[model samples]
Target chain A: MSDADFSLWVYLSRTPLLWLTVTLLAYVAADRLSAALGRHPLANPILIAVLLAAGMLAATGTPYRTYFEGAQFVHFLIGPATVALAVPLHRHRRTVWRAILPMGAALLAGSLAAMLSALLIARAFGMPETVLASLAPKSVTAGVAMGIAGSLGGDPALAAVLVILTGAIGAVTVTPLMNALRLRDYRARGFAAGLAAHGIGTARAFHVDFMAGTFAGIALALNALVSAVLAPVVLRALL
Target chain B: MRGLGGTILANLPRMIPGAALILLCQLAGEAIAHGTGWPLPGPVLGMMFLLLLLLGNDLLPEPLPTPSVTGAADGILANLSLLFIPAGVGIVGKLDVLAQYGLGLAVALVASTLIGLAVTALVFAGVARLVGRDGEAEDAA
Candidate 1:
């Protein structure tokens, strides 16, 4: 509570450096914990890091905006990292090319199922129309889903939250779900991960295996396109 | 002294070409999307642009030196999960809406995403089998 100490706190709190360090340190800790636990499905590092960051912000009464100011640097990488996916795709072109037909079929099935199942389940529960619209694109990546939701008259922020939640849920549940279903094909597993989870799921697939990661990356990109076109049409049909 | 800033800054100078290529492609993607009012994300288009470059590189008389570029890409991707934490943490700000529809939303999201994921994988696997892709080489590897 000393004047100098308080001044230092105010200064550091305003800078991107402070929260950036926190986010990294939290992730490093989470990653190590996951490794220690044999990368168990429950030990998803993003989940752990998000909880940690949220906890820190909550404890300090920091606004999400202030925390984001520091953490936007990490967010910015999603673009470059997305572009980086091309490297692996090129490296594994033959595998992807070979499975092109199956990939297309799976894309249609998965995209419709993602939107329809979410909307129907929520609607049956008597959730409102706006909620249905936003939920329709929940499985797509955040930006695209938010756009779809916005254009559909849903709350864009709510759509963004739902998209991230969908990603997190998909990331956490995918391995166990795949295992329980006895799926052994990395391509199949990865495509599903990206198809359902978007980048977060793709990140999980990459963490597990490279082949899965490659397909997941393609799935992530392709699903965005599929869902953008499908979300509006599907939502209208349902409404 | 710069904390995490040091890490990002330290990695910058040595990887200009790789960094430039990625940013340029992404920028071009944004420009195109903006110009045409495309519905697709810039990053997705950037990925396609980069893929074409990589694919086109194969047809060139001499392959380009791209170790640093790939290396830079690899480095960024290696820590890819780190990038999502920021947006993930923003969930803290949306507690009110979440609170209002917490139970239904949670069940709906979790159930639907798991269902979508499982269905996609199963369908892909089934069709791959039916298509006579024994994937012997893939399996052997």
Candidate 2:
């Protein structure tokens, strides 16, 4: 490459703006493609965007840390975005309140099942204890899952990865599986999606329907509480 | 389109205070959770705090910044999926673990997530039916 081109590359790579722009552009492209495909479950915008961004980083030989310096701005929003969920929850308070009994029951059952199933499966496969701990809270959102995993003597980063994967799997499967079960109750569908997949599933729920989205947010919030307390307790019982 | 864009731009300034309120709630939540050794995450607590304000907004003499926060929040939540991409990309860097335990990890994640979803969904549906809320949920839907 020419010196001028190389110099330009060096400057752009170091700037946070470049990767930040790439993250947005990649999401735009993915969203466009997903929309084109009628927002099919498999055409998940996140899976597409992450792959696109990761591919560009690898192709350009950019370090993940350097890329994150720019992308972290976007990542930081997960916190406020979470807090913003209260808006919808408040708006749909009546619906949420009406479903309170079901929500409580589902939250306990789902939280326990989600944590226990992963730990049991991982153990049967002979995964290490630390890895099991990391896998236990995979259903919680990334930030909370990371903390829960860390407290349980697991690798937080590993927990984060598992959480994302679990979300994607749940997001993709929720619609088809719910349809097959003939479940027309958006509340039940959304509650399950959020309970099992956290934010990613909640994101998918929002796309499918509004009521579903609100219930998903409620489930997400409640599950974070349940899983945090439950993960350590469940781990102790199993170990 | 142009008019909507202009409106969004005009309303952008008002969003700041509302956004700040959200951040403040999150900050207070963080302090409480960390200080008191709570198991809950700060943002989740912040969510509950915001809900309380919303519920009691009528009781306040001047009213809280509900409209502005709604605008800010809707904007944030609408584009929520975009926020996950950065951390999602971190996956590429963590490929070694994926490489070594691909099968087990794959099975564990998929199986657990699906089982959890099905169990929770069925339990909710079944319990809601018994509680007579399933019909209401359907009618509401």
Candidate 3:
């Protein structure tokens, strides 16, 4: 066989292609099982996907880069996807306008609280400054968080991981929290999920209701702005 | 012939701007980050910048000047999960970082999310009242 053929097998062996493929398939299977069990929030697709993928990587000894290479296609689209959120916000312009002042206040207060609380807790635990930077923007969407991390001198990779974990956890807890608080409005529930979790939580909210999705999209965008503004000033002081 | 040509011409101008708007925002966001030497990404700046533009231009009205923009946004968000594949793929390279830092990372994530939820809940509750929706009316609304 030619060097090319030899090289191909070598690359495949070193890479975690089989493990990731299995993980993705396992993720789909778990989702099917969860849906059959009646849409349990504990069985959330994001949560399942993450846990299963983590397990597979650990079991197979496949490196993360290899899986990422096979999976980066998903990452590339986050930018356009985020931009798309604008369409829904645009569609709800009237409602958005009617509640602009309230939404603005909520967005600002919620965002500041998210950042400050995360920073303080991480500090109390004696987490490194770099890790704190990554956590600083975790509440925002991944695309924005990654950018903010790079700008603020946080590890972008760590930020991306935090962003994913944040989304997954937020997606899982949103419904339970809403029910507990008696937040029945689809818009409020959705906005809260998306603002707290970003895209991952928004996806979960969308599965529950369209109004929730709309609110989540609005929350996602607004939080991105608030986090961007808050991360720098806050990090400067903390760092 | 005249109608066919006019149709394509009309769509061509509209479609180009819609596409360009997204690309421009992504690029501008990255550029601003680069220029300012801050941690902010270019696309984020693009988003905020777009919001400013929208506020100025009424760019987000229900009857957007063009349907293509809405369609474009829809197609992107619907399959947003697909975009994470690349980032997930990047995880392979960062396993070492993840391993060394996983616990701290997990703690930060859970903590921030709970904080985010509490803050959101409080803000909405407080704002609902301050705006005179009040607790009773808010529950009703």
Candidate 4:
């Protein structure tokens, strides 16, 4: 509250390194906490880290853009990380190849189910057209979902937010739901989570087991492709 | 030449080769996507490219010289969730939209995600049963 303290705060917030350091430190703390909690899906480190960072930003009155200037370094890793997914895909190639037909069928059915249910539920609640369009690709990863949302005349930024929320919701609820359904197969559980939740779900699958993670990665990539191609057409027909 | 190669490998970080391969694939993918006007993102295309490379390696009589990509990828994948936090934090800026349609959006997202997962899992399980090849068995093999 003092003048000197206020000036020091303003000076430190101006530099991008502060946000970058905060982001990493928050994640480290949250990751440790998640481990301490036995890696429960609901105690997801990313969810905790984001909340801590957002809280810090709000408290300091630092703009998202300013925070992003430093945080984008971490964001840039997503592309290469996605490419690295092929390592797992290659390791499990035989399993994936053997079920190519079933995987394709699942992709089609799951994509349609995701799009239709999202639209129908939103429409039932009388959501606007843009929100409906944005919601159409909510199951896909953020980057692809935003692109699809833009093409479908929706808000790309909103689509990104929705994609993250969808992923978080999927990650949190999937394991319990799978257990209740008695889906004991890791491959089946991973594929279903990936198809429904994309990257975050895949991350959760990886935490569960390596085999599950591999299938989840494959499902994430294939579902994105299928949804990208089919969502616009489905939206056209429905709208 | 073999001695030199060994020396370099010993000195270099273990993650470099895998990271380099992934970045190389991403760059190639970006170039191809941009040049060909593809609808897919560069990273997705890069994944396919890597897949093909792996398949090609399988066809060769000799094993590829590169270090284990899986090992390298494991390092990154372990912290994969952390990479998404920055973007998730951006949601703070969209408080108005969330405030307006928060209930509807929440209902739609949760319901649709659950339905999608259930449908996908059931279909996958049914198909796996028909095929008579348990994924766990294959995984063990």
Q: Estimate each model's TM-score.
A: 0.93, 0.96, 0.77, 0.92
Q: Give stretches of model 1 more than 4 Å off.
A: B1-14, B136-141
Candidate 1's TM-score reads: 0.93
lDDT of 4 at A135: 88
Judge the docking of candidate 3 as incorrect, acceptable, medium or high. Answer: acceptable
lDDT of 1 at A76: 80
Candidate 3, residues A89-118: lDDT per residue as tens digits?
Answer: 666666666555656776877787778877
lDDT for position A200 in model 2 = 88
Every candidate's fraction of true contacts kept comes to 0.73, 0.77, 0.41, 0.69
List, residue by residue over B2-117, the lDDT tens digit for candidate 4. 35345545645875877888888989988997798766777888888988888898889996865656556666676788788888898989899999999998999999999999
Off by over 4 Å in 2: B1-10, B60-65, B136-141
How far is A214's C-alpha from truth in model 3 (Å)?
1.6
Task: Evaluate residue A172 in candidate 1 and report its C-alpha lDDT on the 0 to 100 scale.
Answer: 88
The residue-level lDDT of candidate 2 at B51 comes to 81
Which regions of candidate 3 deviate over 4 angstroms? A1-34, A52-60, B1-21, B28-40, B45-67, B85-107, B132-141
Instruction: Return model 1's CA RMSD, one decimal.
Output: 3.2
Worst 10 residues of 2 chain B by lDDT: B132-141
lDDT string for model 4 (A1-239, tens) is 89999998888787878989999999989888988999898998878999999999998888999998888888888788888888778877777787776677777888799889999989899998898888899998877788889988999878988988999999999999999999987888889889999999998998888778888898898887788788888888877
